[model samples]
Target: MIWSVISLLMPFNLEVMVNQGYLAERSGYWGFLLQHPLNSLFEGGLVHLWFLPALMIAVAIMALLIRQQKTHWMLPIAIGLYLYGEFAGSSAVVTGMSAPIYTRNGPFFSTLFVVVGYLIRERHILWQSRSALLLAMLGMAFHFVEAYGLHQYGQVFNTNDYLFGTTLWAIGLFLFLLAKPDLGRKPWGFSLSQSILGFYVSHLLVVIMMMNLARFLGLAGLEKDTLVLFGTLLTTYLLVKGLERTPLKHLLFR
Candidate 1:
């Protein structure tokens, strides 16, 4: 909701080409103000905002299946859908078709991981042992190999997330994390946690600003990236901290 409002107020500038010609420049402020909220709701107005809606759709489907006592069907269905999506959606070699509103393979691609998460939670899958951690590392290594091989063969898609290797790696890593002992609460933990959502949402904007700042200062290569990274993080942290004192904090960070 906050993002939708932000999109309406400050829609990111974009350029589109049509008929091998660039669109003529015009004042888009009012048009974007009218369209951005709807775009944010359906068409991923700010690109990163796509995650929320896609995850919502995926979770809603899973919840429905669970409510109907059909949990057993979820894994098979999710796996099948993921495979189909990999072969026929967005970066597919066959169709190369994607839903414009959701952007490149949205809920269908996300559903697989969501289902995996659900299974891990409900089934108590654990990976605390040394052997499990070793296996997880091996799985990640194999996924890297698989991705490289696919890229070499020109069969790789938009991302490795659709591949079985990635699924294995994700599951292994998640289990490994789950097996770790919890860190006891710290004095700054609550404040840090509250700032995370704001940080995630605002960091991209900070990075863009920092990129221009770096360029303006004539920084290049790794130095520029490092400066941008730390600069954005620090700026976002401070911004979140300051916003926390205002009533609008909940709208931005919640």
Candidate 2:
């Protein structure tokens, strides 16, 4: 939930859509349900990205209510909701801004994340080294190929989509490491709350600052987006580290 909030606050699609006032006016009951500035961009002006969060919430509630009724419907309803959002016209176009290459595929990919996470939790088959390595390699290879396509052909893909899959692998590794008696059961230790929060909230700001600095230094044409991205990430890491060492960590992270 906190990550969701951070995703919302990040200087991404939501901010732009709101500024354009595109989300305030949408079509259908689903649009109404997702009628936030952000929703306008996700729903493709009718309700794209905005609908996903609502669907997630609605599915969760409905799943609980219908737990005794029937469970098969839960997966179907969730899948349907995600597909409706991704394959739909407007939102598909809108997703390109952040995850350009995978906009059309976002629903499929995002739905996979949710389903996989649920299965992992439900089955308690948290981690196995071979499975983790296989999944991570497959995901990374696909992302690398897609990224290359985007770079060479001017296609767009979502970096976050790749990140999501990789994060899953990280969590799996963490789980595996935690299960080892020598590593200690410390899944929540080391406190990623501050660093993750700082990165999600201020990483874009760091990017903007880096770009402007590069431009002001008359290195505009020479500056690469990858460098800016790396620099921003590094700055974020340092900033988060500093924050964690400060008393204000609680105010920011907690």
Candidate 3:
């Protein structure tokens, strides 16, 4: 959240779409706020960077509901919101037009997924890793099927992010990870994971630079993609590692 504020003030040179925001939303700091004064409440502070704020909202609501012992209402409400999101997103495919609203934000997705996690935890749910993996694969297959169907409808946009298949996919993969909690307990894993926050917030800077350099050098195909991907990861990881040793560590998490 704090880092994004920097981009709003300075000419961060980010293409407006970097946030997956409408072009009209681009403006100087004050103008940006004036354009969508309640943006953080709706699409988040920025659309592409919506996860943290969404997660925060979900957690806050869950905390309140859980304390009141009235969390059972969440599942039904979540279903309603999820259906609305799916309807809005999928209607675009059928109508050959943009959806009337973006429903991938806090109320639609974050609240639902967070409630699911809470229920799983509170109920002490468990699953076999093999079965979880099979479920994951099945969910992925369903997602592809849905995507292909939408493509046949002549929709040029990307896959819908909040389909039923996607929910199943998340549940299965999450259970799989929970079943193997020790997977990332190794020294190397600890070292690599320590700078996750730093990498996430700063990697795009290194990535866009590498992307342009790759294009300028006439790099193409998988080679160019591999270079851009790994180059950004290594560069950002090193920068984060260095920053971890400095005063900026106060601003960013370990």
Sort every candidate by TM-score, greatest first. 3, 1, 2
In model 3, pairs of residues that clash are none
Q: Give the TM-score of candidate 1.
A: 0.76
Residue-level lDDT for 177 in candidate 1? 70
Q: What is the lDDT of residue 184 in candidate 3?
A: 71
TM-score of 3: 0.80
State which candidate has the highest lDDT. 3
Encode model 1's per-residue lDDT on 108-211: one tens digit a residue.
66788899998888888887656566776777787677667667656553465555566676777677778774643576887687677787677776676687
lDDT of each: 0.67, 0.51, 0.72
Give the range where candidate 3 is weakest over 10 consecutive residues by summed lDDT: 6-15
Residue 190 Cα positional deviation in candidate 3, in Å, after optimal superposition: 1.5
List, residue by residue over 1-254, the lDDT tens digit for candidate 3. Answer: 56557434433334453555544334554475566555545553344556767778778877887789888878887778777767667646665443334567656678788888888898999899998888889998887777788778875537467677888888899899989998679998888777777777677667766886786678999999999999998888888899899997888653
Q: In every candidate, how many clashes are there?
A: 0, 13, 0
TM-score of candidate 2 versus the correct structure, residues matched by position: 0.49
